[model samples]
Target chain A: MTGSLVVVGLGPGNPDQMTPEAAAAVGSAEDFFGYFPYLDRLSLRPNQRRHASDNREELARAREALAMAAEGGKVCVVSGGDPGVFAMAAAVCEAIEDGPEQWRGIDISVVPGITAMLAVAARVGAPLGHDFCAISLSTNLKPWEIIEKRLIAAAEAGFVMAFYNPISKARPHQLSEALDLLRRHLPPDVPVVFGRAAGRPDEVIRTVALKDASADMADMATCIIVGSCETRTIERDGKSPLVYSPRSYRGGSI
Target chain B: MTGSLVVVGLGPGNPDQMTPEAAAAVGSAEDFFGYFPYLDRLSLRPNQRRHASDNREELARAREALAMAAEGGKVCVVSGGDPGVFAMAAAVCEAIEDGPEQWRGIDISVVPGITAMLAVAARVGAPLGHDFCAISLSTNLKPWEIIEKRLIAAAEAGFVMAFYNPISKARPHQLSEALDLLRRHLPPDVPVVFGRAAGRPDEVIRTVALKDASADMADMATCIIVGSCETRTIERDGKSPLVYSPRSYRGGSI
Candidate 1:
């Protein structure tokens, strides 16, 4: 039998948010590979096995999964949120490209899921209803200067910005620096939404203005969305305000 | 009977790709409002009613849905992809913000789904593996100059770009103009993916180098992804090449 390797996203953290195709991929695989937390979400059958690893060991996990699939084992790699967005799908493709020739020919399919940014955006009104860009705050792969440049460009271009991996125990200052940079370009009233563990039981979605947003509002689980000048907020009586960027933009200062 | 308005996404025409939460929302709502084509995707029960409207009538659709929900009817507004991303969620929110006082009090929830860009990114390799921005080429709601400015900024910042509503019968020249702008800043070998109706039965995923990409390759249904400078393609013997942008980027000249 020619075993195939399928990389699937488990959505953000909710079972209800997981796509049926992704859930089916998780069910069909005999072996699973991912970081421990993501793999922990899956309730596997007795015949299946899981190979869990450290958080940042994406390449090693991908290589091991590819090797097993090459040996005709049905392998599945799980990722939180969409696998293609700063996740394991790239690592798996990287492994296939650099590995043995047989690995290239192995069947590989990437199943997309509801990414965190989308989940977070849903909780808010529609901050991403306008044009937007997603940037990871972690400097593990790219330089901080590149992040700074992208932030400036996104702000100046009037694109609403979503920041992933915003702050962790290791890097706590990047979110603050990012906000500081945005405050210089965007209007003070621009909404900033900090969505922590969005869609889960402990989901906390908070919206603050650009002038008041700070690093402490976000954690590693949090995805921060900073709106453009055209973004607006609707205040409801005894309800959390709805924030969204309007679809129409007449140059700047809307 | 207090009513609620839930805006749900029907993931790029694939039922299996729809999340259980969105499916649940669709099931619970009695009245559905959306563009006719998007509403046509739903296999509603006998009791469920669909209020189909024209394509450009977003505000009218939102107001009608909100009005129905305010009258103690469970209403659902459907969009093709994620509702918050350039879809009906913003329209709904805009209606509420600008509409009557009671519309604000109606319980509203936005359910997320697998967007076309995510589905397209999954079909190919992870071209959106790093920092990325989504731009809509249709100049219906926004100015052409804003789109032009974003395209240039996204290119300068080295963001993998996803273009939604790439081309239509009306706006045929925007995609070509967008590509011409990218060619000025990006490397010629950068991969451009044209994923038309991704995840649907007639899904077509095609890739070309930036130099060879044209507006003719795309249609209104296509979502075009232009890779950053770091995007790479791995050629297989007979199958289509896998295109991905490495998570790691060493500033410039990767």
Candidate 2:
């Protein structure tokens, strides 16, 4: 007999944010697999096996999760934000396909959660209703050159942006360089919101101009949202927003 | 008697996607106010006052809702997504501040649901992690020029995006124009995902290059999630983008 696997999204960083579907999967799981940091938030049963680790042993950690699921454990692989969105769902999927049994008859369900984009978008105003793209400044996978090419193209096209892995200890200047590329084509006062530790304690969401935001940020659990040329920020409620665009309405009495 | 207002998010477009907290709020409310489209989803009490309307009468209908709560009704103002994130929470807050004795003692609580951003991100890989922004393409409140600026700035700064109102009847050409702007800044091959009726029936989530996505998409219910330059479209087990950026180290015994 084979057990099922469910990849649940535990929200950004709050227990209350877990969906009923996600919470149920977590409560009923025989084993939980996730990153060391993200896994600590769950209140797993005593018998549940939690395979968590630091950033050093990613491959080994991913493999162990499959072994548990293969052994007929109803494993709940959790990820901060949504599992499929730049999180652990793919790793789990990869392991299942590569395993000896091909994970046949194993129910794999991907339950959704609040990702960083929405959390940050809510912190700011509604800036995500157009043609936009998300980019990672982390150069671990591809060359920085390729990243640069993509950034340049996105900038020229005027796509709004959600940035991930933007700045870390090692890659300190990537964010700045990317900003410089934007400055070339876009105006200096475009809306850039830095959402630090969104939905977590010490959460800080502040909107600033493109130039100002570039200088004021550090790399500790942050998501950045940059707007287009048309983005505007008015002090409607005494808040600092350099918003990109407003709603174009005629008949609607908003 | 003083009445309270609870703004609960219904999480994406699926009932299963609703959070426990959100469900509890809706389940316990004596009166409900929302767009007519979502009334069928929530099971209100027989006597529950469910005020629904289309877009043309949003504010007037909402004002009437305020008057209802002003007269002391335990109201649950519901929206498709998070209430505070571009939904009716702000209007409720404004009504609370603007009205006289009837609104003075009313309490307002905001409960978040899975917004379109989260749903789109989940459909794609994790591009919304680091720095991101969501912008509405519909120019109902602001002008198109402002949106273009925000798009330029956000894209230039390497932000990932989730586009709400990416396409609608009135804004058909605008979406393509927005896509063109994004394509100019980003690579032609940058993956942009269109989430049509996410979590609802006829839900279509397809990740294509920015160049290819601009054509053939126009729906009011559509949400577009565009990947960062680093975001890839992998065909894993014949699946679309089962993963995204910020690859954590999976280092545990397998």
Candidate 3:
């Protein structure tokens, strides 16, 4: 039996986003390894061996999946969103690469999921329609200077930004500092979208000016969205939503 | 029987991303209405009526889906990614609101789909691990200054960004100009990730300094991601790939 590894994205929340291809992989899997909540998102069949854990247990989870794949059993390793983004797809790749050569025959592929940024963008209007970028605030691999330099470059380029992992318990001022950097080059009226737990029951999406978002938010679950120099917010139907459209237009049909 | 609208996201490409709930939604859909490519993503039973149209035929697609719901059928308005993000979810809502109250009785709920941003993020790293924003570049509905202002703000605040609809045949310089503005605030070394045809074959995920990206890219099928100060690229086994962790300490674990 030729075992395969399918890494799936569970999406921001809810299951409607799952595609037919994603479902087929899950249904065919003999072993399912994923984050706790992600595994819970599925109702398993009888033959499936599920490996569920938190961040601390990722090592254990990856090992089990690798072993299963090595044994020639189809395995599904899942992530919350697209596995390629911030999830475990990379880890799986690494694990396979480091594992025994017998595992080389396993087919490893990634199934995409919806990231929180797309959900936030929709809730707040077309805030991400133009030139924009996304960054993570985690200081783990990169020096602060590198991130700072990128921020400056993005700001100068006038791209909208989607921020993931903005604030944990320890990194409080990083976001504030980021806001400060943006203020130097961007205009004061720019809109910032604060999306908290998007697609969940407690989801919150608010579009505020650049200056106000820093004061209004400070949480780990939050996904901060800073618009470009041209982004704006309007009270459409009494809903204050941020919108982004290109400036130079020839008025062609879309 | 009470009818409902369960909008689904098809992920970027292939199947592994489908959650159980999302799969069930599609499986149970009595009628599916969406673009042709979106419909091609699913395997529907023969009983389901698929109203697939050209990409530009948004109104016809919405009208057909509305008719199905009006007939008291469990209908789904499908899209490639998150239906809410520049897809058919909003249009379905609008159709229900504008058409008749009879459609209102049909339970109107949104099943959030997996968005492309997360897919791009996973591929490139955690460019969006912090506060960030998204801005659309389309000029169909609103003005361009709005996008500009939002871009400026995102840049000034040093938020990561996701740029959708970045460039098309008619609007090439919009992304370039936006990049120029971002350069004013963001450091020259800030990382930028450009994703084209994300999740689909021919997908491109690459990170470079913001300055280099402006001149290098200008395509419609691309999703641009800009990193904050915290994002970094690391070489694993002599292969350098972008990696963004939430914090420096957390990064140590990876």
Candidate achieving the largest lDDT: 1
Chain A vs. native, model 3, TM-score: 0.87
In model 3, the Cα lDDT at residue B48 comes to: 79
Report per-prediction Cα RMSD to one decimal: 1.3, 6.9, 8.0
Report the candidate with higher lDDT, 1 versus 2: 1
What is candidate 3's lDDT per residue for B68-141, written digit by digit as tens? 77677888877775665566665665555456656556655555555666677766545554445556766554
Q: How high is the lDDT of residue B29 in model 1?
A: 88
| Candidate number with the higher DockQ (1 or 2) | 1
lDDT of 1 by residue, A41-94 (tens): 999999999899988899999999999999999999999999999999999998
Q: Whose DockQ is greatest here?
A: 1
Give lDDT tens digits, candidate 2, residues B99-211.
56455455556666787777766665454543456677777655688678777666655556767776666657878888888877887877787777676777888777787
Local error of candidate 3 at residue B235 (angstroms): 16
Estimate TM-scores for all models: 0.98, 0.70, 0.61
Ranking by DockQ: 1, 2, 3
Deviation (Å) of A149 in candidate 1: 0.6
List clashing residue pairs in candidate 1: none
